[model samples]
Target: MGVRIQMLVALTSLLALFPSLTVTVAVMSVDLGSEWMKMAIVKPGVPMEIVLNRESRRKTPTVVCLKENERLFGDSALGVSVKNPKTVYRHLQSLLGKKHDNLQVKVYQRCFPEHQLQGHPVRGTVYFNSSLETHYSPEELLGMMLNYSRGLAQDFAEQPIKDTVITVPAFLTRQSEGQSCMLHRWQV
Candidate 1:
């Protein structure tokens, strides 16, 4: 009983010393579909939903590209994929999780590994362009996209955002799959 009391007193003292500390929570909502990637920033009291860019626009297509020059492209890689459909890459969200196996992604003519590439397989891995080209792991691609989304949220908040809460769809099952949705609160 004495030990518990002492611990409580110490905690109280620390709280008193840091009484001005503020705990800010951020929620990044991401929804990646075959056609578009949508994200939103959520705060404790804010009611605005901000759309993110796909590299150069207000939104990014749920697409990717594998360049022969060892470059991975998102939607901007679309042009290249269009010119050389065999080299450009796109659409990988549906390949993750339970939906990965015994499934077909005809909307985008690309293939993903049937097994887990990283810790999670919900985001699934893909090959972009030529066989010799360097392919991006699903985690890396999702990380880059979410990182961009976090940047946009920081710009909107106009403050250094460290604490955040991210929201994802119920079906996502990859480590990085839902991360892009939580770019702002990734640290937590």
Candidate 2:
């Protein structure tokens, strides 16, 4: 009887010590790659799961399309890239928080012939100009992609996810670091 009581007490103390073991929260991890983006979710007592987009793909192209009335992201953006090259922005990771004259910006312009790049007046940050008239900053475009990934994670987890962990490349410049901070703030 004493052993049984001691065992129960020990179990209760362990549970109290690790309350998170009892309760589960959904956390989404985003791999913000330059060419593609991916999201995965972790839930208590379950293995980490990869969240797929609407097309049932594990990875999504990092692209955004701006139409006159609406904005499309990922596959939708890529779909219109050929038809509306000037309005579809791709390879935005290189332009975020970068100067207009940066060598990388010039390279991105050459690589992604579908989009037009310009510099913001005050910040000198790179921006994409759509065919219609809207100018989208790299941060804003990145925000759209992040939101899309978050939506996918939410759909898979069947709950609202508030915690997100974003991973970036190791060889990132100060401008890229600033862009990551901006993205972090946007998520918050």
Candidate 3:
């Protein structure tokens, strides 16, 4: 009984001294890739842990499906790609900030016929066309994937997540780098 009372008093004193102290349980690191994306979380005094999506996979397909009023991502989006090709956007990272006539964009279009790409007024911006006649900007499409990744990290950590470090290729061009920064800013 005496020990318990002493511990309680000590905790109370600490709380009083640092009433606004907030403990962060985890930090997330995301590898955003054209073909796949992966997330890992690190907590103080613990080894880094990979966070899996609903499909129980460490890496998720970088795909998004736009419906009339909602969006689906990862495996769910890939599953609907065949039936709803026009509405499913994939290879977001590769297409981001690339002009519609870019060689890489042309290659992607040839490789993935299910989706259509269009040019935006911005020099390196591209848009995806959906069945609803809605055009999704590269940033918006990548944002959806990032948001979904954040959700996975939150779910795995069992806590609210607010920050992440995304990994991009070092060989990206200036335009690509700018677009990547724009995406990061949107997450913030």
Clashes (backbone N, CA, C under 3 Å), per candidate, total: 9, 0, 0
1-188 per-residue lDDT for model 3 (tens digits): 99999999999998899756668667888887777989998876779999989989888998888877778998898888768777778777777667888888889889887777778776646787653557778777777788788889989988877667778765455555455446646332
**lDDT winner between candidates 1 and 2:** 2
lDDT of 1 by residue, 105-135 (tens): 3333335332222222454444222334344
The deviation in Å at residue 63 for candidate 3 is: 0.9
Full-model lDDT for every candidate: 0.53, 0.80, 0.77
Q: What lDDT, from 0 to 1, does candidate 3 have?
A: 0.77
- Stretches of candidate 1 off by over 4 Å are 1-19, 23-25, 52-58, 66-75, 84-87, 97-133, 160-188
In model 3, the Cα lDDT at residue 155 comes to: 92
RMSD of each: 8.3, 4.5, 5.4
